[model samples]
Target: MPLTITIPQEYGYVLLCSTATFILSNWHAMRVGSFRKSAQIPFPNHFATPEQIAAASGDRKEAMHIFNCAQRAHYNFLENYVSFLPALLIAGLKFPVSAAITGAVWSVFRIVYAVGYTKKNTPNGKGRIAGLYFWPTQLVLYGLAGYTAYSLL
Candidate 1:
């Protein structure tokens, strides 16, 4: 067997899509850093404690909520990445173009979800519209991976 593995040509499409995906995740991280600064949430503390929230003024409360949203948006991407990366890998091996296109769509909606989620008064639950649309692309990636696996068997 050859020591070096061959890279598939279509893997480039997967790489580009993965790049877009990570850029979105990192952008959220940068946003969280800025929000943390605005909220005066120092390092070693992920977020304001309940007591701190209770004692905060109106402006501080608003800042805290924004920071919380930024943190949640970034963490939410991390949660999804667990599945996205693996599924992208499995599906890309067999269907790179389709996988890449869907991945791009997924990344775009995640941006929409993050933007909406970071809006103030999110307790109203109106910010989940983008989240609602996020599942289909993910399911498709999973479906492709599943189909690939089944075909190989």
Candidate 2:
């Protein structure tokens, strides 16, 4: 006899959402790298520091702004994703369908956040507004995940 494990449909949705998130995150990172290269910042030997990037930019304020925006977007994604991933996993195991739907929502908002952050000279504070929407939804999703996991225990 062979041993088998079954995962719920909701969990499958979570997996799909997670995959989408991973792909989008990497795409943003690559965009940042492109910005850095275009700015003529030397690619990191091991790790590139803010000082090193600034030194490379050398009086090019526009280049510096673009580099900074890209870096901010990258870091922001990492910060949110790190915490969100585990919560999403736990929640999906307990409340798969809802968790998966929430995860998808979170992923979409994140994309909006990144685009808002990266776009140059966005009018009417659009990027900041988008970020405002993103944060609350992210927080709510994390909370829902935590509550779902806790209820199961």
Candidate 3:
């Protein structure tokens, strides 16, 4: 579609956030493989796919579980962020600074969440703890985006 909004500054922030998430998400995915290769542990021969290599070598059901958790959390991050983009675009046009800051905050929280989640070996309260960082980021984006949507209508 033709351009409907203009906010280069906010767009840049949003794009940067998206790029950061992409890098972090892919890195986590690769770490799943890397952890397997270095595990020196073994799994049943049946578990020999590229994905299974990590699980097998590490004998780390916990690590495997963490990776799965990360995948889901990152997916949720993407889901919420993308959902807010349209609202952000509109919001940025009107409240560029707020929107940009919100986007930046969102990216930061996601990165922190990934770091905290990945470093730990188990999935006890770590996920919940890291999520504290993640939620505000999402909330900021949603708040700003909502404001923009409201202003546009």
| Candidate with the greatest lDDT versus the true structure | 1
Q: What is the C-alpha lDDT of each candidate?
A: 0.83, 0.70, 0.58
What candidate 2 gets wrong by more than 4 Å, as runs, is 1-7, 45-60, 122-126
| Residue range 17-122, candidate 1, lDDT tens digits | 9987778878988999988998899997887676777789898877887787778778888998899878987898889899999898888888888888778777
Worst 10 residues of 3 by lDDT: 40-49
Candidate 1 root-mean-square deviation in Å: 2.7
Q: Write the per-residue lDDT of candidate 3 for residues 1-153, one digit (tens) a residue.
A: 554655555566655655565676676556545544544324432123446544454446544555555555555656775665565555566667677677667667766665666566645427446545657656666777677667655
Model 3 scores a C-alpha lDDT of 0.58
- Clash number for each model: 0, 0, 1
Q: How does model 1 fare in lDDT?
A: 0.83
TM-score of 2: 0.76
Which residue pairs of candidate 1 clash? Answer: none
Identify the superior model by lDDT, candidate 2 or candidate 3: 2
Clashing pairs in 3: 36-54
Decide which is better by TM-score, 1 or 2. 1
Candidate 2's residue-wise lDDT over 37-147, tens digit each? 766656562234567555664445445556567777778789888888887777777677877787778778777777777677654325745754667656766787778
